[model samples]
Target: MQTDPTKDIGSVFGRSWTLLSSNWIIIVPAIIIGIIAGLIAALVTPTYYMDTSGVYPVPVYHSMLGLSLVVGTMIATFVGMLANVVILTMTTGMAAAAWKTGKAMISDGMDALRRPNVLSAMLMLIVVSLVLSLLTLVTLGLAGLISLVVFFFLIYTIAAAVVGGFSGMDALKESFEVAKTSWLTTLIVVVLLGVVAFLATLLAAAFHFVPFIGPIIAAAISGVIVAFFSLVLVGEYNDLRGRAHPAVAAQPPFTAPPAVPPL
Candidate 1:
C-alpha cells in the first residue's frame, strides 16, 4: 500500500498558490473557458417557478406533460453534458500538466481535454453531484452538514481521475484512502478554500452591480474561483503522491583516503 504523503495543511495551500501562480498563462485562458461554459450552461438550464399560494404565473401549454418543461429539460440536459465535457477537459489538462511538470499550460490543458477518460470524470462529477443533492433532500438538509465534513474527499476523486486515469469508482476508492490519511489537513484546506470561495462570491456579487466592467469582473471572478480551487486539488494530489512514493536514496561509493607519503 502507498503511504500517505500529505503532512502539512499550510504547505498544501502554499504549494497550490505556487502552482497557480506559475501556471497563470494557462490558467487565465482556462478560466475564461470556464466562464464561457458556465454562461452556456445557464442559458440552457431549465427555469421554472412553483407557488403553492397560486400567486405565480405559469407557462401556457396544452399538453399535460408541460411542453416548456420537456423542452427545457432536454435542452438543459444536452447543454449540460457538453458543458461538463468542456469543463473537465480544462481541469484534467491542468492536472496532467501538474503531474508531469509541477506546472500548468494551455497546451497541456488542451491535450488533457482530448483524453477519453475526461468524459468519465465528467460523468463522475455529475453523478456524484446528483447523489449528493438527493442525499441532501432525503436528509432534509442534513446532508449539507455531512458534506461540509466529507466534500473534501471529492477533490481526491478528481485528482485520481486526472492523474491516474482512474474510473469514477476507482477514483472514489482511492480518494477515500487519501482522505482517510489526511483528513485533518483536508478539512483545514476545505474550510479555508470555502472561505476564499465565499469571499470571491461576495466580491463577484458586488461586481455584478457595477456597470459593463462589473459583469466582466464578475465573470472573471467566477473563473478565478474555478481555476484556483481546481489547482489546489492538483497541488494536494502531487503532495499525496510524493509522500506515498518518496525518492529512493542513491548508494554512496566507497573511497580510499590518500596514503601518507611523509613517512
Candidate 2:
C-alpha cells in the first residue's frame, strides 16, 4: 500500500528521531567507527591565523613555515577526502538498510554492504557522484539549483536496484519518477538532514576534549546522525513513491461466457 502524501513534512524530523531513539542499541556500533574517523580529521586538520592588525603588510609566517604550511595543507586535503569517503560509506550503509531493506536497525543496515547487488549499487553511486560533481562545478554551483531540487534523487536508483531487485536502468527510471512528487518538501527534508550531519561535526569537535577516546566518541556521534537521517529518507521515499503511484484495487479476471448452441 502507498503512504499518505498529505502527511506534514515538518513531522519528518520527529518520526526520524523516534525511529532512531528506538533503535539506538542496534545502530550505535555501525557508526562509531565513522565518527572516530571524523574526530581524527579534526586533529590532522591545521588551523591558520594571520594577524594583519600590525603594519600594512602585517606579520606573516616565516619562509620555512610558509613552505611547510603549503605541504601540510596539500597532505591534509588528501587525508580529509579519504576520511570523508569513509564516513559517507559508513553512513550510507545505514541509509541502504533503511531504504533498500525493510529493517532500519544498525546491524541490518551494516550488513547491507555484504549484499551481492551492493557492489553494483555502490559503483553506480560513485559514477553518479563524479558526474554530478563535474556538472555542479561546470555550472559554477548553478547545478546546485537542480541538485537542491533532486539531490537525494539518485539514491532511489540504488535503493530500487538493491531492494526491489530491479535493473539499473529501471531503478534509474523510478528515481526520477518518485522525485517529481514534491520538490519543495524534498528540498526541505534534505536541508534538515544536512543540519544533523553538521551536528556530527560539532560532536566530533566536542569529543576532541575527551582524553583518550575522543575520536571514538566522535565516530559514534556521527553514526547516530547517519542512522537518524537514513530513517528519515525511508519515510520520505515512501510518501513520494505513494504520490507517484497511488494504490489501486486489483481487477477481477474476465470469464468467457458459457458456450451456447454453435452458430
Candidate 3:
C-alpha cells in the first residue's frame, strides 16, 4: 500500500476545490441532468389542493395516479435515482481525470460511462442503499450509526469503478479494503465532505427563489458540490491504496503532515 505524508483529508479537499474551480465545465452534464430529472419528477408527482370545508380550508392531496400513487411515486423515484447515478458516474470519471491530469473535459465524463461493468457499479449502489434502508427500518433507526459506518466504508466504490476500472462488486471490495487500511482517515473524509456538502446545499437553497434561472443556478451549484465530493473520494482512494490495514490500537490514526513547515 502507498502512503504520503501530505495526503490527508485537508489536502484532498483543497486539491478537489482547485480541480473543481478550473474544470467547472465538468459539472455541466450533472446540472443538465438534475434539471431534467427534477422536471420529470414534478410532472409525475402529485399536487395538493386547498379544500374549503364549512369552517376551514384543509389541504387535500391528489395523486396523478389516483389509487396507484404509491406505484407511480416509486417509478418516478427510481428514475430520479437512476439519473443521479448516471450523473455521479460521469462526474466521477471527470473528477478522476481532473485530479490526475489537472484537467478534464465533458467528453471525459462521457467516456466514463462507456467503461465496462459500469452497470454493475450502479447495481452495487442500489444494493447498498437497500441494505441501509433495511437496517434503518429493522433497528428502528438505531442503525443510523451503522449506516454511516457502512457509508464511509463503501463510499469509494464508484470512484474505484471509475478510476480503477473495477466492477461493482469488485469496487465494493476494494473500497472496503482501502477504508479498512485507513479507517480513521476515511472516517474524517466522510464527515468533512459531508459537512461541506451540507453547507453547499444550504447555500444552493437560496438560489431557488430567483425566478426562471433559479433552478438552473441551484442545479449548477449542486452539481459543483457533488463533483467536488466525488473528486475528493478519488483523491482519498489514491491516498489509501497499497497501505496495510492498521491493526486496531496498534498505530496512531493516519494524518498527513502539513505542506508548510511552521517556523
Candidate 4:
C-alpha cells in the first residue's frame, strides 16, 4: 500500500496545528460549557478531601453514601456525558468549517447541533460505551487493543454526522468504511491523538489545587485540548472522504454541503 502524500501523518499533524492556531476562538464554546458543567458538578457533589497516604492523592469522602449521594452521582454522570457530546459536536462543526472554507465560527458549531445530529451522536455514544464495556469484561480488562481498533474505525462518526449529513448507525458505518480504506493513516492518527489526550489530562491535573478557580481552570484546559483533538479528527475525516475509494462506493459520494440544515 502506497501512502498518499496528502495523508502523511506529519503533514496532517502540521495542518491540524495550523488550523488550531488560526482558529483558537473555536474553543470558546467548549470553555463556556466546561465551566458551566464544572459549576454544576461542584454544587451537586458531596465535599471531599484528598488523602495523601498513597502515591496519588485519592479522594476521601467524609459524607455517608446515601440516596442524595447516589442521585447526585447519577446527575453528574449524565451532565458530564452530555457536555462531552455537545463539545464534540460543536468542535466537529467548527473544524469542518475551518477545513472547508478557512474560517470557523461558533455559530457554525451551534448550528451543527441540530436535533437529528444530536440524537445520532447521543445514540452512538451510548452504544459505543456499552460495546466497549462488554468487550472490557469479556477480555478481563485486557480489551485495550480491541478497543483501539474499534475507536480507530469509528473515530469519524461525529465528523461524518456533522459534515456529510449522516446519522445514527449510518454515520458509524460510514466512518468504518472510510477508515478501512485508510487504515494506516487512521490508526496513526488515533494513537497520536490518544497520546495528546493523555498529556492534556496530565497538564489539566496540575491546575486542580488552585482554590476556587481550580476546577474552572482545569475544565477550560480540558475543553481546549479535546477541541484540538476534534479538529484533527475533522481534518482527517474530510481528507479521507474527499478521495475516491472502493470502501465508500456503496454510498453516495461525500460532498461539502452548503449547510447542515436543522432536523
Candidate 5:
C-alpha cells in the first residue's frame, strides 16, 4: 500500500489513459463534452474580456465597510470567488458524468446510458460542486484541502448514485466516510495534480507568440489537457473508493457479517 499520495500520481495517470483507451466509445463522448465546453468558453471570450475588470464584493465585508479601498478589494475577491465556484462546478459535474459513462460502457456497453440513474448522477454532481464551492468559501479556502480529500469520493458517490441508486447527498456522505480512511493519500494526490495543472497552463501560454494560430492552438491544447486531467482525477477517486471501503471492493463478492448474535 503506497502511503504517499503523490506516489500514486503516476499510477493514476497510467490508469486514466488505460481506462480511456479501453472505453474509447464512452471516452469519445467525454471528449465531445470537452469540445462543447471549450466551444462555449470560446463563445464567451468577448464577454469575459469585457468583464475582466468587473468585480463583486465579498458578502460579509461588503456590508460592513464603506471605504473605497475596502469596497474595491471586496468586489474583486467576490468576483474571483464566484467565478471559480461556477467554473469548478461545471467542470466537476462534467467529469463525474464522463467517468460514470466510461465505466458503464466498459461494463454494460451502450445500454448503460439508457438508465435514468445516470442522468441523476450527473445532475447531482453539479449540486455537489456548488455545495463544495460554497463550503470552501465559508471556510476561507481551508476547504480547498478538504475538497481534495473528498475529490474521488465525490466521483465514486456519483457513480454509486447512478449504479446502486443512492440519493445524491447520501452518496456524498458515504464518499466522505470512505475517504477519511485514506486522507493522507488523497492530500498528496491533490497537491500533485494541482502542480501538474498549473504547469500545463504555463506551457500552454508559451504558444501565445505565434500570431493568428497561437491562441487557438493554446486553447485547444489546454482544453484537452484540462479534460484529460479531470478524467484522471475522477478515475483516481474510483480507485481510492474501492481501496478504502472493503464493502465496495471490485473483486470477490463482499458479504455482510451475520447480524451479531441477537443481543
Candidate 6:
C-alpha cells in the first residue's frame, strides 16, 4: 500500500497531543518504569575512562607496540560487543511491551517482564545492537550515523512485532519494508522530532539550573515529553496499519463562511 508520509506525521502528532490532553493517567506508570530502568542502567553500568598514552621510540619498537595495541583493541572490542547485545535485548523487550499497550511509556512494563519471550526478544536486541555498534566503530564515526538509523528501525520493528503478535524477525522485516517505502519521509520526521526533543531537553536543563524546585520540575517536564513521544509513536504505527484515528477523521472539512447580509 502507498504510504502518505505527511498523513502519517499528522496522525502521529495529532494522537500524541490527544494522549497528552486526555490520557495522562497512562503517563504516570510509564514514567515510573522509565525512572526505574534508568536507575538500574546507571547503577549497573560502571563509569570507566579510557586513558591512552603515546610512546615514541625506534621503528621496530613502534611497530611491535602498534601490533600489540591492535590486538588488545580487538579483544576489548569483542567484549564490548557482547555487552551491547545484552543491553539492547533487555531494552527492546521493554520497548516491545510499551508498544503493545500503545501507551509508549512502560505501562505494561511489569506485565511484559512476566512474559517468557521477553528474554528472547532482549537477546535478539543485544545481537543487533552489537553488530551495529561494531560496524559503526569500524567506519571511523561515519558508521555512527548509520547506526542511529538502524537503531530507530530496530526499535520500531521490535515495538511493532510485540504489538502485532509476531516474532522478532518478522517484526524486523516488516519495519524494514515500511522504512523502504518511505525512507526519506521517515528520516525527516525522525530528525524533526529529535530536534524538538533536544530543545525540550535544553529547556528542562535550564529549569534544572534553578537553585530549588529546578530538578523536580525538569524531571516532570522530561517525563511529560517522553510520554508525548511514546503516544505519538503508537499513533504512527496505527496510521501505518491503515487505522483511522478519530481525531484525524473528525477534523472539520474546509468550508467558506456564509457572507454577512448587507446592512
lDDT of 3 by residue, 1-263 (tens): 33544457777888898998899987887888887888888777766444455343232233333545666676677777778888888888889899879998988888888877776887888777767766777889999998877877888888878876789899889888888877777877777877988988887899888899987788888888888888888888776774633353356666998799778
The global C-alpha lDDT for each of the candidates, from Candidate 1 onward, is 0.66, 0.58, 0.79, 0.77, 0.55, 0.56
Instruction: Select the stronger candidate by TM-score from 3 and 4.
Output: 3
Highest-TM-score candidate: 3
lDDT, residue 233, model 5:
55
Top lDDT hit = 3
Q: lDDT by residue for model 6 over 1-263, one digit each (tens)?
A: 44555756866676566656654544454344555555555554444433344344466566765676666666555545544333333333344444444333443544544454544454566667667767767877778878877766654554454444445566576566555655655576678779878998999899977988897677677666655665555546544533323454366755899999999
- Whole-structure CA lDDT of model 3: 0.79
Quality of model 5 by C-alpha lDDT:
0.55
Of candidates 5 and 2, the better by TM-score = 2
lDDT of 2 at 43: 64
Where does candidate 3 clash, by residue pair? 1-242, 1-243, 2-242
* Candidate 4 lDDT over residue span 90-177, tens digit each: 8888888888887899888878886586568657876686677667778898997888778778888898898777888888887998
Deviation from native of the Cα of residue 3 in model 6, angstroms: 7.5
Query: What would the per-residue lDDT of candidate 2 be over residues 165-246, giving only the tens digit for each residue?
Result: 5554566666667765555566667777788778778878999899889866776676676566656665666556655666
Per-residue error (Å), model 2, residue 212: 3.1
Compared with the true structure, model 6 gives a TM-score of 0.60
- In angstroms, the error of model 3 at 52 is 12
Native-referenced Cα lDDT, model 1 = 0.66
Per-residue CA lDDT of model 5 for 1-263, tens digit only, reads: 64566666687777666654554443333344444555544443332122233365455344444454454544444444443333333333455555655442333423333445544554565556667777977899988977764565563454444434556466566556645766667656656667877887787698888898887667665555544655665666666767666666857855897787756
Model 6, residue pairs in steric clash: 30-106, 85-126, 89-122, 89-126
Q: Show how many residue pairs clash in every candidate, following the order shown.
A: 1, 3, 3, 0, 2, 4
TM-score of each candidate structure, all chains considered together: 0.70, 0.59, 0.79, 0.75, 0.53, 0.60
Model 4 residue 200 lDDT score:
82
Q: Model 6, residue 98: what's the lDDT?
A: 44
